[model samples]
Target: MKPIRALSNADEVVRLLGSEGDMSPAEIAERLDIPRPSVYRLLDGLESIGLTESVPGSRARLNLRWLHLADQARESMVEWAGARELLSELVERTSQTAYLTVLRGHEAVCLEWEQGRAVGVLLLKPGRSLPLYAGAAGRTCLAFGVNVEEYLDTVTERRAYTADTLTSDAALRADVEATRRRGYVFSDEDVTDGIAAIGVPIRGSRGQLLGALSVSGIKVEYLAKRDAYLEALLDVAGRLASLNEAAIQ
Candidate 1:
């Protein structure tokens, strides 16, 4: 039997297994049209690296060790000290939840969050991952006009979490257009029903998009005072972006 590496099918097998969850060698072989023995050999190598683990009475499953590397890479973005302080101030001033997030592997991960005074509002914690197709943070990142078409393609399969979620391609395009025109993104019941959010892009010194800073709250109060909240949200976003740019210098 030929070695898995010599057959040039090792990586594909690993990817298939990682994506499809636990599967026996025969199942992986059937899916990839490779010999079962080759799949087992590839799994052996993957297991040695701690990227794959054997499930009792089942095939190997993907391990989360790669996530540690991914987290390190994500944190390599500009230091969060200044940005987090500013975000905390924004939340204190507005008395609304504020979040700092960056695009991470097709999702927006909250790097920081400041709690609002609103009772019963859903609290977002640091390290929480949100879908790229929903919420103000995601839209703000998407509206930054950096390879947007490619990013949209990558997020096309995201499931809508609410009735107001922009699931259609055309609608998402339109939303992005509106967000670009407004210089920010706003959402009402898009991610969670009865929630509202507004966000703007944060750019680095060279004008590279660093992330998004957003203010979010419950729907009722937001609707009653939408314009005022919009102003505050935009103000904080602009301020944060400027601070980041200056710090990156």
Candidate 2:
């Protein structure tokens, strides 16, 4: 059998610990499909570097170094410094899950979220992302954040997330036109059944695309209160846009 590359194995161990939390060497080895000895070697190296630490019951988990790294990452997103408070306010007003998303490559990445009482299950959350054509937030980015022609050229395949997902190029083009015309997206069962979302583009003071603000809830409830929700989203987005770049930094 070929030997596993130590660097790649070590990196995979870190990602696994991040997603699955603490695990024993054997557990990590089983999950990675590598030998137990290799797992131990990777864990030992990570512990030596203060990246992972041993826990009770022979488990190893990522240590405080990751917390520092996470804080640094958070600090870099200056535009979102006050997002937690703003999203909390949105959740209070609408009683639905509120999300802050930014376009990264061809995906819409959820940077932050506030869960509400009305909707407990969610497809997008902090650290998760969706394809640019699959959900309200994603479609908003597709419509406003990139060159439509170049983006379309790069899409090799579009996966259907649900029965209502728009996978065809013509459908996506029409959706983009509508999103630009209306200034928001009303996603109905495109990502998850019984779920719907409204997404609006947020721009900087200079009208530069900043990100997306979205709220999601039960389909029927969202449709019934669509106008009110859109008003709330636009209001908050306006405030977010008004934030001074120099002040945020």
Residue-level lDDT of model 2, residues 125-173, one tens digit each, is 8877888998989999999998877888889598898999988878989
* Model 2 accuracy (lDDT, Cα): 0.89
Instruction: Give the alpha carbon lDDT tens digit for every residue of 95-162 in model 1.
Output: 78888898776777788787887744453556666766689888877777346688777766878789
The prediction achieving the highest TM-score against the true structure is: 2
Quote the lDDT for 227 in model 2.
96
User: What TM-score does each of the candidates earn?
Assistant: 0.68, 0.77
Best by lDDT: 2
* Candidate 2 TM-score over all chains jointly: 0.77
